[model samples]
Target: MSSAGRALAVPAASDIVDAELVNGDETAASGVDVRTARDRHLSAETVAAIEASAAASTRRAYAADREAYLAWCRQEDRTVVPASAETMAEWVRHLTVTPRPRTDRPAGPLTIERAMSAVTTWHLEQGHAKPNMRGARAVLNAYKDRLAEQKDEAARARQATAALPAQIRAMLAGTNRTTLAGRRNAALVLLGFATAARVSELVSLDLADVTGAEHGYDVTLYRKKVRKHTTNAILYGTDPATCPVRALRTYLTALAEAGRHDGPLFVRVDRWDRLAPSLTRHGRTIGDPAGRITAEAAAEVIGRLADAAGLTGDWSGHSLRRGFATAARAAGHDPLEIARTGGWADGSRVLARYMEDVDRVKNSPLVGIGL
Candidate 1:
């Protein structure tokens, strides 16, 4: 008649098998049926549904955090059941201030706040009287504010180190295009700057995707990041383009000359006619493994290029993308246009960051000045 009695009546063959697998003959001899160990308060279907709503990455993180939280509760002799508002609040507080054992670092407010939210949601869905998460919400807000401050600080620091587009142009000009590697690097840099592409998008390109037209060639950048609004609109190259379309065209032609087609536009070439793993088995060679290039690889490429060009700084692949956005804004391109080109979902925020940097450099008294 009771819920616990009903749960006990339902057969759980899988649970018994799992118990036998873990404990061998210990569970069978004790006469303790593992099938009856089910959480009578909640159905297995409910738990499964909750997990289905989460993304794969989210699920993994939540699982790890949940295990840690439950283990801690067990160690402290606290109830693992999220059956009351008080219990939920206690858990949220514990997560907020507790130092993680392995890292010995205080759990970041956002990380713990997210874990608490997941737990609260799960508990509430299972008909538990969990807290409303208002406290957790406040902590999350504080965490975001901290992040914003850090971002602002980073933007300022980068502003001081930011290179001008013309400076990048100067560096590009130094590359000796006579050799295959030199030509490839030049093309890579030009495409990276011109498209304002993430290093991943830049590297994932194929020769087939790039086409030459009478006016200029179009390098169809798939999986590009652009403003959601302008996603429907096709953005062509800038007028009076800073870099020539001929440059890209010439590079593609060079690839053809090398007898490479139906593969990555950028191949790893150690010597003449020698190819590297830049090209996948599918006949597509990526500039940076189809945008999954490690930070290390990106750093290596930037460092090598910078060293060769005799330029100084800790430039990385991101610098190329960021530099393009910064330069475009300085050149008087509309912020929305920059966002559309860069595949940003929010244009205003990105524009504001760039405008702030510009103002800093110009010492413009009217920075953030209203129209």
Candidate 2:
């Protein structure tokens, strides 16, 4: 077998039998089972470490993609471990042409792209040659090009309307501050808007990450690129009703009442309105006592609050981040300043693209011209 093909092979019973024979004398002398020792040597520590390279959410996504690919391999009686270029090309074609189960619609270009990435990563990690297929790339490119001809479907699907300043105020008003869940939700929304924080950053926050400041609060955020903590100042808004600092303070008071001193700043709440009890006291609790909320749940929180406020549109975790950028630009804040507040690295095009629509409207040549 070729070296690449050999790397993909799982251990067979014959190989194990040979190993047992080789170590049989040692096993007899030591009064220990050689097979057991060999199994210990072949533990999954390496696999665990490789999987740990990705964040939890990314790992989950990759796992699902890998499972799907394996299932396809099982159905086709193909080797997934050392998946050949032809096999990969066929998989891509299958993804693009096959109607999804229980639906007539084929997989979208982006979905296929992500699935391909997952497959590629799986191969590399499993000690197999990367799936190299110009044919697959060409096919996917053409498919994407065809989709691009359709304006609505081709445009970025996540390009939903941003929640502006008034819309955010309405969302805040919709929540009742008296209840624990309400207080947490209100603080979560206001803080997210004020900081323009990604859902991951928002959920990863710990009590120690925050400190009281003269005007508002200073939050220490962990920058993944730098692998260090950088502090951002969240200033208090003028209005008490909409002030993020005030809302945060109220939530902190509730936290104190619950006898929580450390751990995740934002925890989960059950459907019955029961709060995820604090893990500070090491007491048993219903639901996850780990305190930190998942990024997906964080997105749902924003959507649910937005729905309650009578806003009409698809809202996701990206909404808060996008809303902050758009709202900041509309309020006449300098683009560079807004970018800095949102943690955009200098000279990055992300901030520019985000503010492009806002700039087009504000700097339009037809603004003062009569119809």
Candidate 2 lDDT, tens digit per residue, 146-172? Answer: 777766363354564576678878888
Candidate 1's TM-score: 0.56
Candidate 2 lands at a TM-score of: 0.74
Q: Where is model 2 poorest over a 10-residue stretch in terms of lDDT?
A: 1-10
List per-prediction Cα lDDT, in the order shown.
Answer: 0.60, 0.76
For candidate 1, list the clashing residue pairs, or say none: 200-291, 203-287, 225-343, 226-343, 264-285, 279-285
lDDT, model 2: 0.76
Q: How does residue 191 of candidate 2 score in lDDT?
A: 88
Estimated TM-score for each candidate: 0.56, 0.74
- lDDT, model 1, position 1: 31
